[model samples]
Target: MTMIHAPSGPNLEQVRRIVTEIPGPRSRELAARRSSALPAGLVSGSDVYVRAAGGAVVVDVDGNSFIDFGSGIAVTTVGNSAPRVVERVIQQLDSFTHTCFLATPYELYLAVAEELNALTPGDHVKRTALFNTGSEAVENAVKYARAFTGRPSVVTFDHAFHGRTLMTMTMTAKNRPYKQSFGPFAPEVYRAPMPYPYRSPGGADEAFAQFELLVDNQLGADSIACVIVEPILGEGGVIVPPSGFLKRIADACRDRGIVFVADEVQTGIARTGAWFASEHEGIVPDLVVTAKGLAGGLPLGAVTGRAEIMDAAPTGGIGGTYSGNPVSCAAALAVLDTIREEGLIDRAQQIGSKMSSELNSIAAATEVIGDVRGRGAMIAIELVLPGTHIPDPDATARVNRYCQARGLLTLTAGTYGNVLRFLPPLSISDDLLAEGLGILRDAIAVL
Candidate 1:
């Protein structure tokens, strides 16, 4: 098979170049400055500050280049500084950066909403409300559900990650850095069992049954306003639920008049080889929360849902001062256009097939790689102790460090922090991806 080459940027080659150490001289200087200037709470995965990035490669301050597999935590599906996104953002910036969409409405905001309504998973009449972050989108989604259904309770699942806001943090399942010491969380939020086939004792069927029991016994369906889930859990590890699990959950929500919410903050926008991950299950969520890849690197989030449910909130009930900044909206419009014009959804599937083949081959030879899972480019390898399912976060961390030292940018996930997740940009070239995977294999081999 012929390998596709990534679009080259000025002074940016697709190959990884480690001129200095992982945190080179300049990066170390910058890290010192960052430590002095910024709060300690803001943790970064890498100390190598990026000077420029395009396609699959990121150039650091000290002239080191790395093959990026994180995509800035799935924020840049189209790649950093994608041509169309930069063009649209520049065009919008030249015209007007921000007039505040709520105060002075703009066509770009409406255009973004229209595109989202049309692109998200559903043929029903849909409406969209924009926000600045995924957490805000999720918060608004819950509000819309409660307002529409007139119920206060919301149900999330085990190993689910909504966002970082108070309400969303409450909805999130992880307890450490995300929820520890965060004070009084919002009430009426309940947790259900998620279908994690790899580690489940009774398998997918029992997991689904457990979820249903949770809804029926712990929190009755009538009291629930929304059932929010990540079709493929992102930060809680790239845990793909069993086949038909999403459909069944959607059906249950529909039957009980509970609003079904798919938090596609990480899995949407062609990241999963589909416009929205919910489409994989043929399930149409009443409301879909989106961010990350929505604006191709800009801070933009959206809640697209059935018109009635979205409209149920009063006119001024759901917007922020910077809800849909015009510049971000323009970037999103370009992102949608690029996705269609570039056939990124197909590209994602191709990347996924390749990554799965390579990673599974490595897993076959590596006992520490307990499971290889995910769809499209959203892939992950859960590390465990040899010959057992026990998590090995130490191995996961070692692999991550090795990959970083070898000039390959990777990310770690899972509630137990034992999963290595890969979110390569959809535009990455096959050769670059192979090189990064080669580094990963070498790292695992050393273990």
Candidate 2:
């Protein structure tokens, strides 16, 4: 087991100049073809045609390279096109592609599950099931909780971004792009106001009261099966709940018979300075859903929980055709090994602290930056109209476009669409981080 602190790689400018026009002429043609072939429903990110990527820089098809602060929306925690990931993926592909864990059980899948059980929060004996996407994992978690608790409803917080599936969409707070035309969503999924201290009514006490009132007036404790929440609201402006909020929720769930399910899809797998963000509050959710960075860049999702509850589903009740695919499991194993070997959890904290400090300094110079909040590497600064809390979505959009033109990749989040989140890979270099922040500062100043 050799330890590796990410290797020295290509410089920022060298990587950017190679990928010329962001999307270049050839890339635009390919995108046009994609538009014809793929449905418009399948939305795509900014058309930065990618050729190759390594460390903090991604080279587009036009040979221009750009510093990646987005990490494909936090999917590539170990960095894009990592050599170790490439080699392992190629080796796994050569060995086999997919055997479908349900049809032919594989060692790697179970191994990954075992690893997740040990790694995720909780000391009790735990069980895990794998899936292909965060939506699937979230849906399965709800199913498992209901089956286990014999309850009818599940509660989710406002402004939370779970996934785009029917059940997950119902769980999510946004409606326009994600749920506008996709509805008539799954029933019995309830939404409660999340504890966003910056805008929450009366702070923690009122937020707790609202949660309790919701439980009392609408969805009672006995009728609820689970309360699914993100440890640190990822797409909800990278909002960090005030201290004791999660603990109180856990206590509420315990007092009743509800399962506490932590939707760690975006905040887990060392993205928030810990192996799992739930650990930050010393809270152990009865069930934990994880994905995104779990398998480095590979598509993998897991639902891990107490053994009895997770096993509540009847025989043949839960399983996917491609659940626990071997190749994905292999990649996940490598990702876990890499995180531990490289001490990425600690690095996430150090990097996030540095980033937050720098951003706060810049925020002091601007009236638009109404708030700076988040935990570990999952940080965001909400933009608002000067002297008011009105969300400045237009300013956010402008900042995003400016970043793209200047060779930096950043993403916007929050219900009001005014938060700029930074989810850079924990493995990103210090110099790259500084340069990306510099670009961001320039963009903000000009805006």
Candidate 3:
């Protein structure tokens, strides 16, 4: 298969040029309009309204260009308006927009499912179900797991972010924004200790032991349906579990007859130098949930797993009206094609190496940087008080503001809100990454 190279067009320069303040006059006007027109609950990290984005740079309405390190929160991994994805989506659109996959199934949907079944880890007989968002995929995975195991309790990790849906919000660990006032949540969802190397009371081994004990005593393996975890926690500060931690959990699930679900929403689709983050640990989870970067910029989510587990759901039990829309499926096929043909997995590794090196160098000099962690292109630095490991959310916000002011778009995440996570597109050029990293270094230096 031929690789789809980055599309070239006007204003696609891989350079940052700020013509106005971070939120220029035009953007300010848009923000004002947005405030009145939209709900106050929907908050945006940046005030700049984007006009166009491709490769590494995003151009705002006021003609300011900024290096994009967020990639629309890891949605546009192949870069915005990727040529292959656009072509496929347009072709599918011209053929048909939506017939409602449940009403009239289509070939594109089946094709995307087949691709996912083959691409995800584990060579066992696998099946896939599609949905419109990560939350839907995760919820459906739980449904299938519960149905297959005949259990009521589901286990999730501390600092794990599944989705915004009620059930997923219950699975998540953060309280201020995600969980505050959003109770009472779904029942039978238990939270366990995750192996966060930086903050764990003991180390990964002890964390694993405690997690196993929790499962055995508190939740009881016989009553558990599944254990859901992000191989690398994304919104919870890009926390990567220590080596062998994930495998140990998987083994525990296997020995207990519980379904092991790996939530690869943010770490899949070549964002983590692998098709799925579970591959890093050589663990074959019984069920895998994916979204975010699955369909370029279009919305698509998938649950791929062992055939018996997936088939546990009754007919008409796990579908939506717009599930596996043809247009999104076409985009997903193109994304998979692009990842394989363009060798983006290797590119992600290269990006991760470059980013980790630069960030570690900065951390060595900056006392506020408590830790530098993550794998592949999914990396982050946790900001803390100058002399202690106490979270410094203010410092994190200042760095984000500084980067945004200087034409570098960055994202901040963490359970404590003190982590600056980087998820730059694999399509970003080396020079553009260097420029963005330089801006980040300056932001940290001034702090």
Candidate no. 3 TM-score: 0.97
| Candidate structures ordered by TM-score, highest first | 3, 1, 2
Greater TM-score among 1 and 2 belongs to: 1
State the weakest 10-residue window (summed lDDT) of model 3. 1-10
Model 2 TM-score?
A: 0.95
Off by over 4 Å in 2: 1-15, 18-23
Q: Residue-wise lDDT of candidate 1 within 238-297, one digit each (tens)?
A: 999888888999998898899999999999999999998998999989999999999989
lDDT of candidate 2?
0.85
Tens digits of lDDT, candidate 3, 1-447: 122233243237777999887798888888888989999889999978887788778888877889999999999998877878888888988999999988988899999999999999998999999999999999999999999999999999999899889999999999879889989999999988887778873488878888888899977899999999999999999999888889999999999999999999999999999999999999999999999999998889999999999999988888998889899999999999998898999999999999999999999997999999999999999999997989999999999999999999999999999999999988899999999999999999998
How does candidate 1 score on lDDT? 0.90
lDDT of 3 at 211: 83
Model 3 residue 139 lDDT score? 95
Which is the winner by TM-score between candidate 2 and candidate 3? Answer: 3
Model 3: per-residue Cα lDDT at residue 143:
99
RMSD of each: 4.0, 4.3, 4.0
Candidate 2 local lDDT, 319-353, one digit each (tens): 88988787788888888888888898999999889
